[model samples]
Target: MSAAARAVVDTAALRHNLLSVREAAPGSRVMAVIKANAYGHGLVEVARALADADAFAVARLDEAVALRDAGLAHRIVLLEGVLRSEELSRAAALRLEPVIHCPEQVSALEQASLDNPLRAWLKIDTGMHRLGFPPGEAVGVARRLMASGALAKPPVCMTHLACADEPEETVTRSQLAAFAGAVADLPGDRSAANSAAILAYPESHMDWVRPGIMLYGVSPFEGRCGADLGLRPVMSLSSPLIAVKDVPAGGRVGYGGTWTADRATRIGIAAIGYGDGYPRCLGSTDTPVLLGGRKAQLVGRVSMDMIAIDLTDAGDAAVGDEVTLWGADLPVEILASRAGTIGYELLCGVTQRVAVSYV
Candidate 1:
């Protein structure tokens, strides 16, 4: 019995979610964002699954390189672009489009004389201060890049929406307005929507749309689950119950005895914990885990490699019964809210120690 815990990647669900994105932005092309190992769903696996995507976007140069090495012919974009000459040269070789977010990136592209000119994206900092040039300077930057003759075509323009998830905020509209003004006369395509924008803001969908967490079946909006948006979950984390023990009333359970047994309780020890990418913060609340197709409350502190679940209510639960941390039946978003974190962290935090099976 080597089974401890496993992350099961549902390829069919992934495909379904991609279709959802396409449906949301039927008039726009989709650049499926697959950075951070496809939000920890396995980079190469996700790329192969989303072969129908118009393009793929990654935060780092190496991720794009990995896709190229895998012989995937999909258009891969380096979201952060390159910082040095070597990276620029290699990006050109790999046919990866780098998003020029800063003046230094443009300079690097200009100075790096490659045998072939590269296709690039001009990023305008609408409101996200983390990257890109000021929206006011976007047109000038595009003009400079054009004059520099470092591109195979006029660069595609893009801007990241900082508050697209918060529909109440006016930032999304302002960013869209700024992006529109910035690229008003630019001779290239435009992209502005992320997962949140794809669902909430139709006007932001320009020539292309970039979707990240939605492709993994996680909601980008607050106070909502993926199911609310017609998306299918792709990652289901589960482990087999190793032991079932009966605790007498007033008995303490797990580390520090934080969770006291108010009544006679049946606890099932599952082989999953923070070490396996289960959020350590989850135990602070009565988050439920699915066992025997029923809800079992998680109790006590989450150990490095184990967790205790109050399975008294789940009739017929026994050793070898599978416990689902989050999946098809147990939404990760609910677990994330209980843990005081987002679903993205929970998915990306799955450590290498846990076995992953892609189906």
Candidate 2:
């Protein structure tokens, strides 16, 4: 049976992107970030494909549990750390590492009594004020964890780069400096680089590099595609032209009548929309999709389960012809730009209904 919409994941491209990460940061160990179900590329599936990763990092404990349940023995780091004391035991039992980002988490580790201590990471908030301990408090927090004996070893000191994607920005340099100064005296491996830093800031790739978007072969920077960084795209979103017809010059298309046919126009209705994670905000004539390998414009407001494509140029396009939403040929970044979002959201936004096939 043919799926209405499908996302094709290329395992080889994923491995190839991993190689790209290695080539960019040859000296650093990779902690592949597979959070958000491997950025919607299927969690356990991507892990199995990139089994060579030094460790895997996810945003939540359940994600780590999913990986563990899948029989993946790779070291998994919970980026958000455990929320409560009870989760600590499960995290410990699963042999999962949690990022000690706050005083409460530190307190939890201090009070918990576990048979086996957990190997953990200490996140210092250099500039990205979202998580982690403040710079001055980082050393103190590490000491507290060490004094508690909850950690199997010295915690791996780490921080996130807020502006690493913007190479010309001074914030990245300041954040790097702050992180270095904060953890200089700490006795453990240090990590700071994300996908953007791995490719641009070699100095920040201290001990571990967390490649998230790049692992799925998407660029972390604006105005750049993964191909520019020697990475192959892993996911190709495609659907079939399920219906085709001609509309009169004065006729309006789709909901709200936002688009009107200026001339006799041929339209193709593709089986993809916001319901399938295709951006509804992308209902514009400027938005492009490939119909039978020819360029076509998206017209009118996107419906729940379909998008109308102006097939004026691709008059030869017929029902059942493949229409590519985004892929190696049409970068998701382009579509994301049209939708006023980033490639990351588009990749992660793919819904459950869309069938995923691995190559």
Candidate 3:
């Protein structure tokens, strides 16, 4: 581990979170999305953690290859279909399922003749309108893939729900209606729910639930926390107190001199900063770290390698005492809310400058 900052990933906690996903969607297959290096928890690590995951989903073909190279045997789905005609062969060779969202993807699949044709998902453009065949065009596109024998089996009908997080909203139901109508009488499974739907909209959990942030132990609901959903945080962004000193009343510390002591105070220098993915903006008028398990206010602007925290009542905290940026006792949602962002951003933003130690 690096001397200044450390990120510890708990494999046990990861397993617990996957179990929670299954518990929430007891009947549906769990297609755990491990893209963006498993939301910055390290791709291979998170994939290994969810060993029993029904399948894995990545944004591209290269990510699917990475898992296969790592000896991961779970079915892999490429959320974005092949980028070119050549990739279709590689994808089929790897037994990777591509979500053919656009007409071009269907064209690429049609061009390829694999000994083992690929099993693919047909993405329908619902209200999100991000990718995929328009809902009205879904059936025709699917029929072409089916008749051509480019696909090994019927395409899995899928659509993204824009408002599944808002439980009372009717948008998801409408999207499901449109998606179901297009794939009607199509003898294949359907996948619609994301992490939010797996937890909040059980009806949307048709055949598979694609969970992203939830696998990293983050809640989809605004007021709720991951812990409340029986999820455990997989990463602990921790650092040690490098130094501590006394500052006279009205004295300022660190860059910009933004925080001036109102009374005689004890100041602590934490050895990780924005360079290590700790939010620099959080230094002023935002959440800080916990010291000796007591809340401490951050002081001044964060430096490239250090941040100062006003620790007046931190109470005899030593130079090497552990400081939690977020994990365990300090919920990431708490820090994210105070930073005017979300946990997903903060978690994925953890930079490579920090050392990562797996547990």
- For all candidates in order, the CA lDDT equals 0.91, 0.92, 0.86
lDDT of 3 by residue, 221-298 (tens): 877778988898888888898988999999988887888888988888889898988887787667768887887778
Q: What is candidate 2's lDDT per residue for 54-85, written digit by digit as tens?
A: 99999999999999999999999999999687
In model 3, pairs of residues that clash are none
RMSD of each: 1.1, 1.0, 1.5
Off by over 4 Å in 2: 1-3
TM-score of each: 0.98, 0.98, 0.96
The order of the candidates by TM-score, greatest first, is 2, 1, 3
- The stretch of ten residues in a row with the least summed lDDT in candidate 2 is 284-293
Question: Per-residue lDDT tens digits of candidate 1, residues 1-359?
Answer: 56599999999999999999989999999999999999999999999999999999999998988898898998899998988888888998889999999888878777778877999999999998998999889878888898888899999999999999985758888889988998899887999999999999999999999999999999998888999899999999999999999999999989889999999999999999988988877877878999888988999999999999998889989899899999989889998898888999889999998888899
Candidate 3, 265: how far from true, in Å?
1.6
Model 1, residue 159: C-alpha shift (Å): 0.1
